[model samples]
Target: MPVDQPQPAPPVPPVLPADVELRSPRPEDAEAWSRFLVAAQRDTYGALLPAAFGDDDLAASRIAALESAFAEPGDAARRIAWRGSAVLGVASASAAPADWEVALGLVPAPASRELDRLYVHADAHGTGLGHVLFDAVVDERPHYLWLIDGNERASRFYERRGFRHLDERVSTGPSWGHIPMHRMLRG
Candidate 1:
C-alpha cells in the first residue's frame, strides 16, 4: 500500500474566502511553517504510511528539509497561502533549466520549470487554496511534478489543470515501503 496518501475529501472550490492571503515565505516563519508541513504530511500520509509517523528520524528530516528550503530569505522563492496567522497552503518550484526527476531515467527538458511541492491543508481544500498555490508557480505551460499514486484526488486535480501522467514512476524512500508515484507533466 502507498505510504503517502490523503483521505477522501470534497472537491476544491473555485473561490477562496476573502480573508485568505497569498504570499512568500518569511524568514521568521520557519517554525510555524515546519509545523504546518509536518501536520500536512501527517494528514495526507498518515493513513497510507502509519509507520513513518512514528519514526522520529523521518519527522526530524521533514523539519530540517523545510528549514533548508527556507534557509535563505529569498532562496527557494516559496509561496504560501495564509489565513491571518495560520498557513492555508504552500507552493514552490525550482529555477528553470530544469530536469524532472524520475526513477529509472531523468525526464530531461531545457528551460522547462518543475513544481517542487504544493500542499494545502484538508480543512482549506474546498477554499481554492490548491489553485491559488498552483498558479503561484505554474501557469498552463509545460512543467512536471511527481504525485503519489494513491492520491487519486490530487492526481485528478492535476489532470483537471492539464497535467498528464508519464509512463515512468518512482517510489518513496526506503522508509516508505517503496510506495509508487506517477510523474505528471503539462505542456
Candidate 2:
C-alpha cells in the first residue's frame, strides 16, 4: 500500500476589521483624505517620484485641490475607508470622458467607466480594505484604470481582480515626475 501524500491548505481570504467604515467623501474629510493619499503615494512610489514630490508645498497644493473637489459637485463617485477618525483608503470612479477615449484610441462605450484613484494606506494593506474600497466604487461593468509601470504589488492586485494590461503606455507629465503608466481594462 502507498502512503498518502500531505495536502496543502487553500489560501484564506482577507477580512475587513469590524470597526472599519466605508463612506462617501465629506467636506470635513478633505484634509485627512489629502494627507492619507500623499502618505500612501510616498510609501508606494517615493523612490520613483521626483524630490519635489515630497515637499510641503506639494502637500498643501494637494490639500487645496481635494478641498475644492470635495466641496464641488462632480461626476466622480468616491469612497473613503475609515477606521474611527483615521482614513484607511480611498477609491473613485467616473464615466470615461470623450477626451480620454480619444487619447487612448478606445471606442466609446456608454457604460465605460474610469477608475480614477485607488490608494490604501500602508497600514491597511492585507486587511481587505483595498478590495472593499474598489468594490464600493466600481461594479461588474466595463471599467479601466492606469497602473504605474513598476508598482508590482498593485499590478498583481489588479490582475487578480481581472484587469488586463493594454499595449498603450503614457507619461504622467512633470507633476508626477514624468512617470510612465500603462492602462488596464476589465469587464
Q: Which candidate number has the best TM-score? A: 2
RMSD of 1: 10.1
lDDT of 1 by residue, 1-187 (tens): 8698888998654666789878777755666676676678778877676565535533666657656667663434478777889888878877543332434345453226677678898888866778878877786557777788778889888999888888866776565556787678788
TM-score of 2: 0.78
Going through the candidates in the order shown, the clash numbers are 0, 0
Model 2, span 63-117: residue lDDT tens: 6777777777377789998889988898989878447557756565334788878
Q: Where does model 1 exceed 4 Å of error?
A: 1-15, 53-77, 96-111
Computed on alpha carbons, the lDDT of every model, listed in order, comes to 0.71, 0.80
> Each model's TM-score?
0.73, 0.78
